[model samples]
Target: MSAGAPGGGSLDPVPEPTGGIEADVRRLAEYIGGTERRLAALPPVPDRAPHDRDRAVAVHVRARRARRAFLARHTETVYGVLTDGLTRPVRLADLVYEAADRFPGLVPTRAQMAAERRFVQAEKEGREIDQGIFCGAVLRSPTAGRHLVETMLRPTPRARTLLDGFRTEGRIELDTVYLERRGVAGHIEFRNAARLNAEDDRLIADLETAVDLVLLDDVIKVGVLRGGTVDHPKYRGRRVFSAGVNLTDLRDGRISFVEFLLGRELGYVNKMLRGLLTAPSPGDGRERSVGKPWIGAVDTFAIGGGMQLLLVLDHVIAEENAYLSLPAAEEGIVPGLGNLRLTRLTGARLARQVVLGGRRIAATEPEARYVCDTVVPAEDMDGAVDRAVEALRAPAVSANRHMLTVAEEPLDLYRAYLAEFAVVQAERTYAPDVLAKVERRWQERERRRAARGSVR
Candidate 1:
C-alpha cells in the first residue's frame, strides 16, 4: 500500500500529502483504521514457523509505519488534537495508548495496541497478531517522536519528589545505580555489580533517576558516568565499566521497547544529550533547563551499548587498558544509533569492522582514540575526570556542547534515524536465531564463569 511498506519494492520516503491537512487526516484515519481492522481479522498463524510469522507480521508493521510516517507529514497540524491539546502529562511509555484512546482510525484492536507499545510480555489478549508489528511506528514520526522524547525528559513525579529531598541529602542511592555530587560534578555510578554493570530493564529507572538528579540539581555543573566494581570473580573488585546490554535478560525476554530500549535512548541517554525539557522546545520560549556536559570514565571494556554511548558523551576518558566494540551483528539487534553516529567517529570502513565485524579495539590501538578523548592509566583516571570536569564547568560550555552536537548530527537527523530504527530494532529483537545466539553466549559465559571459580 505504501513505498516503505515491507514487500513493497522501496524504502523510499513516503510522499507528502496532496490534500488539505484536515482532509488528509480524516481520509488517512479512515484508511489506516480500515487497514488495521483487516490486519487484525486475518486468520491465526500461531502454528506457523518463526520466519513465517515474521513475514506475516512484517506486512502489518510496514503498513503501520507508512501510517506513522503519513502522520509525521501532518504532525504540525494533527499532533495536538491527537494528544488532546497537550495538557495531559504523558510519557513515552503511555503516549500512544493515550492518543489511540482519545482518537479513532489508529490501532484498531487491543493486540494492535499492545504491539504499538511493544509490550511483548503482556499477553496478546486478541487473535494471533505479532507484538513487534508496530512497536516503533509512533516513534517513527518526526514531531510525534520528539514530542514523546520531550515528554520523557520532563521530570518524573517520583524524581521531583526525590529532588526536593535530595537537594539536602546530597546523595541518593538505588540498588543498581547511585548519584552523588563530587565537587562540581554529579557522578552516576552504574552498579549492577553482579552483572558487571550490564544494562537491562531493571537498570533504566534508577539510572534515569540518577541522570535526572544531575540535570535538575542546582549545584551540579557537570556530570560523570562510570561503571562500578563487580562481584564476578574474574572482574571482582575491579570496575568493569559496562559489559553492555545484559544478554541473560535479553535472552529471557525481560527487556522491552518503551521501558528499556526507548526508555534508555529517549530517557537517560538522550537526556544527557538534550537536557531536561522543563519548559519544552516547541516555541520561541527558551528552555528553563540546559543540557549538561558529561565525562564518561571507562574501565576494562565498553561493549555494544556502552560503545554506542561514547559517541554522545562530551568527553570520554578511558583507562589505558580498556577496550571498546559494537558487536551489533552478534547481538542480532541494531546498536542504537551507532550505525548513524559511528561513521563520524571512526569513518565508514572502521565503523563497519566494529559494528559488522565485531572487532574489539583496545585503548592502546590508535583506532580507539577516535572514540575516547584521553586514555589514562587506571590510577590517573580520577585526576583526568576531575580535570575534564573543571574544564567543562564553565557556564557557557553547554552552549558550545549543544552546538557541537548539532553540528556533528542535527536533532532532525537523529529523529529521522530513530523513525526507521524503531521498526528495525523491534523486528531484529525478535529474530529467530536471537535466542539461539543468546544460548550460545550464555553457555560461553557459564564456561568462563566456572573456569574463574576454579581458578579462585
Candidate 2:
C-alpha cells in the first residue's frame, strides 16, 4: 500500500527527465525559431564590408559593454580625463617644475584655469555686477541705502551659488556701494583694494558703464628711500577736518603678494573702481547723483598700485603707526598709479618731488606737504572719520555735487583721467631703468643669505 500509487501504476519512479520531454522539446524548438528570426531580421551586410571588420564589430560590442559598466562605477575619473583631454595638455613635468620654481603646488589646475578663463570671459563680456551701493542715488539717512538696496545677482564668488552656476559676471565698476559700506554720509568716488589690475586699460574700455563716485582704499604703503624700505599697507589719503585713519597691508611677507594683488585676488576691486569712475552714477532729479566716499577696514600692503590709491580719494583717515612709502623709484620702476595720482593732486613739481624722491614720508610729518589732513592717534581714527562723515553728510546735496564737479576742473586731474595710460607707458620704460637694478640687488642678497642658511 505504501509503495504503490492508488492504481499501482507509479509504484516504481520514472527514471526519465522530470519535465515533460515533448513539452520541453516544443519550447526549445520555439526558442530556436525565435532566435533564428531575430538573426534573420538584421540588415544584411554589404559584400564590400570587410570580413576582418566583423571581428572588429564583436570586439567593439564587448568593449562597449565593458566600458559602460566601467563608466558607471568610475564616472568622476572618466569625466576628469575627458576634461583634461579636451583642454590643452599640461605636462606633469612642466607643472611640477613650475611648482618647484617658487610656489610649490600653486600651479593652476584645470578647474582653476577654467575658472580664470571664465572670469576673463566675463570681464570681456559686458556683464556688470552692480555692487555700487549708491547707483547714483543717496539715502535720506545712514541706513537708508540698505532699505533701497536690492542686490543684482552678479557672478561674484559670494553671489555665485546664490544665483547661477560659476559663469562669468563681466567687469565691475566701483560706485556708491563702497561708501555705503564705509558708513560715509555723502557721495564720494571710492575704490577698494579689490579694483587694482594690470590690464586696467582694457577693463576701462569694455567695462565702463557709468562714472560717479570713484572709490579706492589705501591699504598698504611701500616706499624706498636712502637705504631703507618702508613696507605697510595703510596710508592717510586726504583728511579735511578729522583725525586721519591708516590702511595697513596684512599680507606683505609672502611671495604671492604681487601676483595675488594683480591677478584674481584683487581683479574685482580694480574692476569696481574702473567701472565707477568710467561710468559715474546718474544724478538724481534736481540733485547731484553719485555714491559718497568711505574707507572700510583695510588689511595688507598696498604696494605701487595701492600707494597710488590715495590720489583717488578726497579725504582719508590714517591709523596711527602706519607705514607709507613709495620704493618703486628706487627699484628702477615708475609708480604708475601713484605718479598719476600725485600729478593730479600736487603740481607736476611737487608730484615729481614726492614720487621721484623715492622716500617714505611719515603720515604726521609737518614738513612734507604730502599729507592732506590732520593726523590723530589710531584710537581716535574712527571717531575722526565719523565726525568727517557727519560733516560731509550734513552738507546740502547740491553744494556737495558742485564741489565734486569743480574738483575735476583742474587740467591735471582731467588729463590724468583721460590719458591714464601715460603712467603705464612711463612705468614700462622707467621701471626697468630705475627700479629693476635695485630689485635685482635685493633679490641677490636674499638668495645668498638663503644659501648660507641652507648650508648651516
Candidate 3:
C-alpha cells in the first residue's frame, strides 16, 4: 500500500506499515485530518458591522480552543511519530504548516492581527505594546511554523575561528568581557562593571566570541555566564550580573538594528542552541547537540536583555536578592526572545504581567522561581553554581540534555520565533516615533541620575 503525499499530492508508492511506527503515523494523520475538518466547519470571522465583531471573535476563539484541545490530546503521539526517523526531518515543518493550513479559522492568521493589536494598544495607551509581545504573538500563530521552517532552512553566517587571537590555556580578558576555562567548565563573565555590565555592541561581540571559545574547547563540558566586580558606589566590590542592553548606545543611535539581531540571535543564542560545529546527523538529519549545557549565575539583577539571556540557559542560579524585569514596554523597545521563551517557563498570564504590565519579579517570587531553577543567598551563589556545574557534568548529562532539548523545544521553534522577531524588531527599532521615545526616555533617565549624582 502507498501512503498519500501531504496536501493531496499524488500518492507516493511507499512500503507497507511494519505495524510499528508507521501505524502510529497513520493514526496521527487521521486525527489531524479529523480535527482539521472540525475546524473548517466553524464559522469564519464576520466582516459586517462593529456589533458582529464580538460574536465573530468569540466563535474564532472557540474554534481555536477546540483545535488546541485536539492537538493536546494527540501531542505525545504527534511528537513521537515526527521524531521517530520514519520521515525526512526537513519535511516536519511542511507537515505542520499543511496541518495548520487545513484549519483556516484558527485564531485569525498572524498577518491579519499582527499590526491591529499594535495600533489598538498604541491608540489606547499612547504607545505600542512591547515589541516582544507583538512579535511573540505573531510567532505563536498557527501559521508560524511555515516561517520557522524557512528560517531553519536558511544558512547562518560562518563563525570566525575561536582561537584567531587567543592564548591557549589561560585567562583571556577583552575590553568588556572575561573568559577562563577552569577544569570542566568555561566561565564567561561580563566585566563592564562600570556600566553595570550593560551590553553594547562591543560587549555583545566579545560575549559571542567567548561562547565560541567555550564551544571550541574540548575540555569544557559546561559553560557559565555571570558578572564580574562592579566598582560603582552602590555595587562596589560586588557582582552585579547585568543591567541588560546599553541604553546609552541605543539612545545615541550607536546601535544598529542588524547588529542587535545578529549579536543575540545568530551569535550567542544560536551558539547556545546549535552548539559548536555540530551539523545535523545523516541518519535523522536533525541538528546535533554539540553545545555544552549553560548555567547562568545571577547576582543582583538581570534586567531587559539580561533577563532575556536567561531564557537560553539550561540552568539558572540566582541570588536571593536578584530581581528580573523586562521593562521594554516602558522603554519603547522589545525584549529579545523573552516573549517566546518566557511564556514557556512562566505561562502566558504571568509572562504578560511581566512583559506588558512591566512587573518586576523578585528572585524569591513564585514567577522568578519558574524562571530561575535555584535561588541562593548572595554569599552562597558561588557554591550553588559550582554544585550545579558539577551536577551538569555528570555522566550522560550532555546526552540527556540534548535529548530533552530536541524532544521538548526543538530547533525549529527557535528559528520560527527569531525569524518573526527579526522582522518585527527591525520595523520597531527604526520607527521614527520609537526612536524619539527612546531618546526622550534616555534624557529623562540621565536627568534623574544627574540629580541623584549617580550618573555612570
Candidate 4:
C-alpha cells in the first residue's frame, strides 16, 4: 500500500529518519554479535552418515575440478568481470594474471587462465550496493486438511519460567492463549501444545499464509490468510489477529517440513502486508510512517525456501542442535529465496560461496559467521524466541517499516535476486544436464520422505 501521500509531513512521526545509518549500523552490530554468540553457545550438531571427512573433501575437490574445467571452456566470454574501485576485485585480477601472465611455472593452461581473468574482470565491475530503500514481509502457513489454526494465549507460571530461562533479544510472554478454528467455532487455551501439528500433515498438503509489506513511501504491513482459522477470526469481517504459530519440531526427511521452514507456507506474507497498508486507521488525520517487523523462530532443515524465509526477516533465532542444510547447488536447483536474502544481507562473496557451493553451512562452523544470526541452545530456543518477539514488539510500527525499506531496497538487491531466478528457470528448461540433476534431486528427496513415512 502507498504511504499517506508524499508531501504529507507524516514521515517524522516514524523513527526511521531519527535512527539514521549509524543507528541502523548499531542495531546490525548488536544483532551480528548476538548471532555469533548464539552459534558459539550451541552444542555440536550430530554428524550424519556418509559424513566421512576425507570423502567429503574428495567430493569438494571434484566439484572444484569441474568448476575449473567449466571455466577453462568458457572463461574469455562470460566470466571476466569488471568492478569499480574495489580492492578485492582488483586482487582477484592480479591472482589470475599471475597464474597466467606468460609465467613459466603457471599451473593452469592458457585457456583456464583466460577464464580466470574474465571472472576477475566481472567481479571488479559487478553490481554495487547503494543505501537505497528496502521492504518485505513475514508470512505464516496454516494447517492443512483436517488440521486448523491453533494458538496459545495467556502466560502460565511454567511457560513464564521457561521463557525467563534464556538470554534473548526480545521479551518473553509465556503461554499466552492458544486458539484454533476449523469450519466450526474456534477454541482458545493456555496449554503449550495449543498450536499443534500432526505427523501426517508434514508432507504435501501445501497450506500457506501470505503477507505483503512494502516500503514505497514508508513501511506498510498487510496480511492475507487462506488455510488456518484465527483466534478471533471475526474482526471487522476478519478475526482480531494474534501472533501465529511458533513452529519447533519436524521429522527429518519430510520435504514439506523443509518447505515450511523456508517460509514457503508464508508465501502470502507479502500479500498480507499489502492489504494492511491499503487500509487506513483513524489517526489524527495526520501523516504516518511505518517500519517492518523482525521475526524468527526455530527451524530444523531450513534448506531451500525455509532458509529464504529467514533471509526475508531481519532477525532469526536458530537452534544450535538443529540441522541447517542447503543442497540447491548440488541438485542444480537455484536457491531463489535463500540467495536473494543472503546476497543482500551478507554481500556477494559470502553469498556466492553459500549459494553456488550448494553444500551445508553449519551454524557452529567458522565459515557460518556470515549466515546465521544466533546459534542458540536448542532447549532454550522457545525462550529465546519469546524474548526476541518481545523486543521486536517494543519498536514503534512506523520506525520498523522505515528500516524495512532500508534493508530491502538498498543496492537493488532484490532486482538481482529476481534475475537469478530467471537464470535458474532458463537453465532448468534449456540446460538438459541441469534439468536432469534438479529432477533427480526432487525425486530423491521424495523417496527419502516416503521412507520416513511422509505422505508425499
Candidate 5:
C-alpha cells in the first residue's frame, strides 16, 4: 500500500514516504502565511452613522444575521479551542483576542445602540423583539468573553425561571419593585416610597429577582437601578432614592436576621458583583458572572444598605441633591461589603470616616466623585442616563468592563470579603447591643416625625 493512501492492507509492506509528515506541516505553514497576508492587506472597516433609527435597525439586523450564521457554524470549534476547562479569566481573554482576530467589527457599536432603541419601541407596540438577533453580536463581538457564553449554555435554574416569570408579557407587577425595559437598558426601581424606598424583606427579594432578570435577558446590555417618588402626602411627587434597610422591620423582629443577610449578600449584592448563577449542583460550586453592566441612578439618598449596594454598580449618576451614607457603625453592625469596596473607591482613611463616622456625602462633594461617575441636576437626570447608556453600548465596552473589574477588584477578593460579611452581619444583626441601638434610632426617628406632625 502507498504510504499516503488510507486503508492499506495490514500485510502490505510499508511504502516509502512521498513527502510525508514534514510536507503536511509545511503546507499548513504556507496556508497560514497566505491568510495572514490577506488579512493584513484588507482595509480597516469604515464607520457610518445611521441616517435615522430605521436605517440603524436595518444595519443591526443584517449584521446580527451574518453573526448568527457565523457562530452557528463555528461556535463548537471556538469553544473547544478557547474554553475547555480553562480558568474563567484566561478563557475570557483568549476568546476576546481570538474573536477580534477572526471577526473585526463583529461587535456592535453605536449603530447597534440606535437599532436597539428602535427595536424596543416596536416591541412596546406589540411587535416581538427578534431573539435570533438579540445575542448574535455578543458572540461575534470580541467584547463578550467565552465565560459569558459558557454561562449561558448552562441550564437555567428553576429559581431563575420563577424570577423571570414576574415579568411575563412584558410587564413586571411587583408591589415593592418596578421593572421596565427600554431598548437595551433595564430599569429596576425601588418602589416602597412610603418608607422612603427602604428595603424590607419582600422588597429585597423582589429587587434581587429584578436584577436576575436583567442578567438573564440577552437583549439587555445595561441595567439602571433607581427609586420611585415618595408616597407620603407631605413628600408627594418628590423623589426618595432609598433610605436603606427598613429599620422598622429589624426592630419589630418582622424580618429574619439571617435571611436578610443571605438575601442581601447573595441575592442583591453578590448578584450584582458576580452576576447570577444557578444553585450549584452537588460537587460543583463554581460561580459564573451574569456579565451585564449596572448603572445606579441616585436621585435623593442612598443610605446604609443603599449606599453599600452602589459599590456593585459599574457606574453611578447621582442627582445634584442626592446624598449617600453608611451608618452601620452607629447601628452596631459592619456595613455589608462597605469596608472592602468602599476602601477601593475612597482611600482607607475616607472609607473609615464614612463608615465609622456616619458622614453623609453630598453628591456635589469631591469625595462623592470618588463613588459617582457624574452628578447632574435632577432635571438633567434623564439626559445624563441617556448619554451614559449610549456610552456603555460601545463595541468594546464589555471587554473594558471585564478587564477593569478583574484588575481593580478581582472576583476572589469579593468572594473572600463576602464570606466574612455574611457570618459577621448575621451575628451582629440580632446582637443585644445592636438591637438596642437600632431601637433607639427608631424611637428618635419617631420623635422627629411626631415633632414634624408626621410631615416627613
Candidate 6:
C-alpha cells in the first residue's frame, strides 16, 4: 500500500525541493514516475479480486496523495512545463493525458479520466476529463483553479454558434438546457425534466452553453433561471425548479467534481454571478467580468445544488409552496458552494439550519423571505419574473450591481473560497466510507418506499 521510492522508502508528504525550478521539477517528476510504475505493477482495477482491488485503491490513493501534494507546491512550474508556459494552454480535458505523456507519472490517466460528460467548452475528448479529480488535485494551489475559472469565463465555441444565430432564432434548445430570448429578458430553463432538473455530467456543458448565450447576446439585458416542466408523477406538468445535483448520479459515481462541482461553480454558475468575459484576464481582475443581473424563479422545490443556485441570483421569485434546502447531511458531501455563499443571503444561523441541519425552508416562512425576493402563488411566478426582469434590466442596474458585488463579495474572496472547496469537496467525493453511508441511506429510503407501497 506504500507509495515510496524504489527499495521501500515512503515518499515524504512533500518531496524535498531542489535548488532550481528545473531540479525540483526533475526530482518530483522522478517521484511521480515511480507512482506510474507502481500503478502499472498493480492488478488491473476492473478485474482485480475485491481484496486486491481494495489494496490497489489504497496504493492509488497514496500515489495520488504524493502527486497532488507535489503538484500543489510546484503547480505553476509543473503546469508551465506541461502547457508550454501558456503558449499551448491545454484545455482541462487534455491536461491529464498531456501530463501522463510528458512526465509519464505526473498524473495517472486511470485516476483522472474516471467520470464522463459532453458539450463544446467542457468536453473535447471521450468521457469529459474527470476534472473533479484533475482540477481538484491542483486547485488547492491558488492560481490553477483561478486560471481555469478565468479560462472558462471566456466564451465556449458553442456559445459562438448559438450567439451568432441568437438574434435570428431567438432561442437555442439543447438536450438538457433551453435558452430563449423574450424581449430584453433571456430565460435559461433547466430541461432535465425526467430527472427533476437535477444536475449531472450531461447538464453541465449544455447549461454553461446556455449561460454563455445569455451573456453573449447583446439583445438580452437580463437573465432568468427557471426549471422546465417535469415528467415525475408528483410534479407532472409543473416546473419543479430543481431537485438539486442528482443524488442518484453522485451515489452511482456519475457526478464529476470538475463538471458537477467546479464546472458548475466556475462555469455557468460563476458566470451567472460574474457575468461573461470576452477575453482571458490575467491582470486587473476587476475589469474582467461584464456581468448582468439574473433572476431565479423557483417553482416546486430547490434542493442542494438548486438551492445553491439561488445564492447567486440578483432576485428570486418562489411559488408560495416552494421549499429550498441543502441536503448535505443526507448526501455526505459539500452542498456545492452553500457553505460559502448561503450565509450572505440567510444569515449564519438559518444558513446553518439549511446546510448542516438540512432544514427545508418553505417559501411561506418569514425566514424564507430573505432567500427569495418574492413568494407568490404558483400562478403568479411568471408575472413576478417579468416584473423582476423589467426592473433588473434597466441600465442603472448594471452599475449598481457592480457596486454591490464590490462591497459584498469581491472576486478574489470567491476564488479563495473555491480554492478551499476544490480540495475539501474532492476529499468528500472520493472518501471510502462516505459513499457506503450514502448507499445505506439510499437503501433505507427504498425500504421505506416498499413498506409504504405494501401498506397501501
Model 6: per-residue Cα lDDT over 349-379, one tens digit each: 9888888888999999999888888999988
Off by over 4 Å in 1: 1-79, 87-89, 99-142, 281-286, 443-456
| Whole-model alpha-carbon lDDT for candidate 1 | 0.73
Better of 2 and 4 by lDDT: 4
**Order of models, best TM-score first:** 6, 1, 3, 5, 4, 2
**lDDT scores in order:** 0.73, 0.31, 0.62, 0.33, 0.60, 0.73
Clashing pairs in 1: 140-419
lDDT of 3 by residue, 1-456 (tens): 122222222222222323354453454344434433432343332233444444333333333344344343443343334335223332222333333343332222334334333432212111111223223333444444333332333223322444534446546787898898888888999999888988888787687778877776667889999999898778899898898877767656555443454336655776675565444433443353366799999999999888888887889999999999998787666788788878888899999999999999999987787889999998898899889899898758766766776776676576676656755675566455766776676779779879888644
Give the winner by lDDT: 5 or 6. Answer: 6
Regions of model 6 farther than 4 Å from truth: 1-15, 19-30, 36-54, 82-91, 110-145, 281-288, 441-456
**Model 5 per-residue lDDT tens digits across residues 131-239:** 2122322334333323443343233343367655644544475779888878788888888978889878878767766777777777778888888898866668887
| Residue 347 C-alpha lDDT in model 4 | 83
Compare the candidates by lDDT and give the number of the best one. 6
Q: Candidate 2 at residue 426, lDDT?
A: 26
For residues 1-456, could you state the per-residue lDDT of candidate 2 as single tens digits? 111112111122212222543343343333323322332333332221454334333322332233223323333332233235223222222322332232211122233333333422112111010001111111111221111111110122322232222112212334312112233332222232232221233222221221111222121111100001112122233222111111111101121111222221122333232211212233441232223333321122234444555444445545444445556555444454465456656678766656687666555565233543545675686576566555545436334544554465432333333232322332232222433453455567579879988999
In model 2, where do residues sit more than 4 Å from their true spots? 1-289, 295-303, 367-370, 395-402, 405-435, 438-456
lDDT (Cα) of model 3 = 0.62
Please tell me which model should have the higher lDDT, number 2 or number 6.
6
Could you tell me the TM-score of candidate 6?
A: 0.85
TM-score of each model, in listed order: 0.80, 0.38, 0.63, 0.39, 0.61, 0.85
The alpha-carbon lDDT assigned to residue 361 of candidate 6 equals 91
What is the model-wide C-alpha lDDT for candidate 4? 0.33
Which consecutive 10 residues in model 6 have the weakest lDDT in total? 118-127
Model 4, 1-456: lDDT tens per residue? 111222111111211212343343343333323322332233322242233323333322332333333223322221122112111122222322332332211123344333323432111111010000000100011111001000000111232343322223122222333322211111122222222211112221112211211222122121111112223212222121112222112112122211222223222232112112221333521133222354544333355544554555545666674444445665454554565567766688867776787656666776555556677875676466556544554437535555555567532343344333432332332234543554464568668768877643
